[model samples]
Target: MNNDTVIVTGSKLTIDEVAQVAINGAKVGIAPEAQQKLTESREFVYELVNSNVPVYGFNTGVGANKDRKVEADYYNQFNVNMVRSHCVAVGPEASQAEVRAMIVIRLNTLLLGYTGMSPAIAYMYRDLLNHNITPVVPERGSIGEADIACLSHIALTMIGEGDAYYHGEKMPAKEALAKAGLEPIMLGPKDGLALVSSNALAAGQGALVLYELKKLIQLADMVYSFSLEAFKGNVSPLNEEINRVRRFRGQNESAAHVRKLLQDSYLWIPHIANALQDPLCFRCACHIHGAVRDSLHYLEELMDIQMNSSDDNPCVLINQNAIMSCGNFEVVNWTVAFEMLGIALSHLSRAACFRTIKLSSEHFTGLPRFLTPDPEHIIAFGTIQKPFTALDAEIRHLANPVSMDFYAVAGDIEDHCSNTPYVVQKTRKIVDNLYYILGIEAIHAAQACDLRQEKEFKLGIAGRVVHQKIREVIPFLAEDRNLTVDIANAYQLLKSGVLLHALNS
Candidate 1:
């Protein structure tokens, strides 16, 4: 876990590898090929700037500043000024993982030979990662306008002008570099521009979001399984023949996962039931949940593309006849995908919440009211009520659609946006919310199974595993004085992935 050993060679750096670079113990470095690419791109930019060519960021200005020409002598100052001027982000500092990802991802874009950064500048970033010296990047600011405010903080740290985290402590950039036995280098003509003009912050957020969403989907399925058995719900909706008629790939895959999980559950069989069919949506589970699975798959593909792309502007095309200053900066693709993901995530919360409510309702499962095992224990409410009381409201709030909101700024220069940061942030929050919600469901489900077991009835192997997992954290609720503690304990199981492994098993 040392910072010096987690370098990405570009040969087999998977998604986990990228995420690990963000963690405190992670170390990252550039491969030899990437270093060579950085050297060539830097040389190419230097050649053009020395020849007095009109590049967008080198000799010329940026955005509205595109028309302003800079004196050759002031180029170095301009580069340094770019870092100092744009370090304007304000909000909570990003976690070390996010900052490290920003560094690695920005380095990946530069390795594409388009950013025109000096090899020394690239090596400086590599050294920062290798030595665990990461810039303290803020979590907010920047409407994707060149990521200037965001990356500037990182760039400032590189040249000993900003603050950074070293040895789990925040300190002045100079002091951190000194502690790491390093010296900050000057920014080359294109170094500041190269460092700032990237969507790495957003991209890194998207990458981490993808990682968590993948795990969330698995957890959702497990919770849904536990919830299903808790209600002794009908299972006709999972008929392979019915799913085959739809011919949807994700639907089929979801059906398989559900069927495998429920295969050992004897209580799910229709033995002279009063109703021939159950609610096809939540009861069938696979059909509705499968849609989410399909959507996540699509989002994962888009996220992978986004994470591995160069979403900067005025890409340096040394080989091409022209510099392509395109809309790679727009981020509409990420916006749409993330919003779509938000919708899917909301649906999941809705489904899980409905199941939780159903398990607690006397009209549905014929179980004790609120699945409390004993209703007399329904204590008073207040600032410190039961955990499920707070859990109920939190899950409902998770359904809010952040992607649908809008704000116009800078005289409408950035009129509309997907609010991707909000979307990702909410998604993370909802996942946390669902963890608790499912934990409550786990307790209720296990209680229902215990009730059945006392009657000389039993769930199959799958149900038994789920029941035992829940019991490990929350014992059979003989009398629920404080449901809060049990609810929290159940959530810990979900967060720890112990509940997930049990359900999947």
Candidate 2:
């Protein structure tokens, strides 16, 4: 467990902080003011409940059944039934980290006082996270208008009616809560809807994906730098003045980082190139990577809003002393941004696959074909391209837009859908696949660098560190034994952040 604690103030939680709590097991603390707001919001909800004003999902029923009335006497059971019914989400279950992310995100939004949920429910979220009692949540069955179908599993655990993980051990939610010295929450008016009706599932998972991507973009730059050195590629394209002429943020950022990584390398030596122009994969690497960064920036901006703002339907207005039905749950804006990101990552995947292919060709690198240690006897990287390209192909397929593909659900009242969860889920798959693709690319680049005998061919600061790190786990492809083991090791090296740590050190 991380000793660090993330203080949630309802409106200021960051993606990095989310990573800390979700992935690192950091304890969570709610802001005092936010807790007070929860009290006020709960009071307002009771006031409305007594008045019999028939607010949607409050005193009245929800969805197509909105015309149905919910008397105050049945508030507890109605809410419980709502939660149990929404647990229609199917397996495979979400990871413990993902469930933690969902809890924290939902907890933050509840503090905004827009959901009118009981303060006890909010505290339950804090307690669940603090105790490491992660609810077993299914990863599917959400149309993304809201993650009600999926998130209900979390509410199930809150009421001590489902399975949960307590300190990394899976057991009944009741047992987990008891072991953690906590009690099951009693659902009140609107409590069940409050617990499940939000986009937290998608938002939480998406925030993690963004965190990984931030590092991935930097890693992509680092690997590309090493590949440039191995290719003896022209540094003209990376020249600061040339990249700055266009004034694109992502391109300039990628180009500048690559330049920094390639600092003091022989690539900077004027007239060191084998040709005036390298392949587009080598020349436009930064631009392609830049496009990914640019797309990521857009998604992050939208995700920030999604995380902090109220995504509740029938949002409570404490100032106005009223509850208003609204569509704050709609997440199409960020859903499409995720779609665009998938496309951007597809381009990144293709570029990496192309770069790896170029690295193996004798025509491009002037090294023996397939980066063979002994071309006469060893058939090295020739067949290895198939795996990385297959992974890239999967990335290309995952990049296809699916946000707009949905039928009218919920008795046609919820006619539209963003499929936000699936969009974010697919983007995550794209990032994971890139790790393999880039790992293979790194393997090829390191091999090309080792095979280069030119007196002028030398690694820069980042290259030396990356090469050393790769060789530490994955040796030079000395007469190709099982490349599958090598590929797996390279993936682990990149995924483990070993190379990034070395570069930073």
**lDDT of each prediction vs. the true structure?**
0.69, 0.92
Clashing pairs in 1: 3-27, 6-27, 7-29, 22-97, 387-484
Per-residue lDDT tens digits of candidate 2, residues 1-505? 8789999989998999999999999999998999999999899998988887889998888899899999888989999999998899888888899889999998998889999988999899999999999999999999998899999999999899989999999899999999989989999888988888999999999999999999999999999999988988988999899999989999999999999999889988889998999999999999999999999999999999988989998899988988999999999999999999899999999999999999999998899999999989999999998999899889989999998899987788888999999889999899999998899999999999999999987799999998998999899888769989988998899999988998987
TM-score versus the correct structure, for each prediction: 0.89, 0.99
Q: Please give the lDDT score at residue 359 for candidate 1.
A: 64
User: Candidate 1 at residue 229, lDDT?
Assistant: 69
- On TM-score, the candidate that comes out on top is 2
Q: Pick out the ten consecutive residues of candidate 2 with the lowest summed lDDT.
A: 408-417
Off by over 4 Å in 2: none
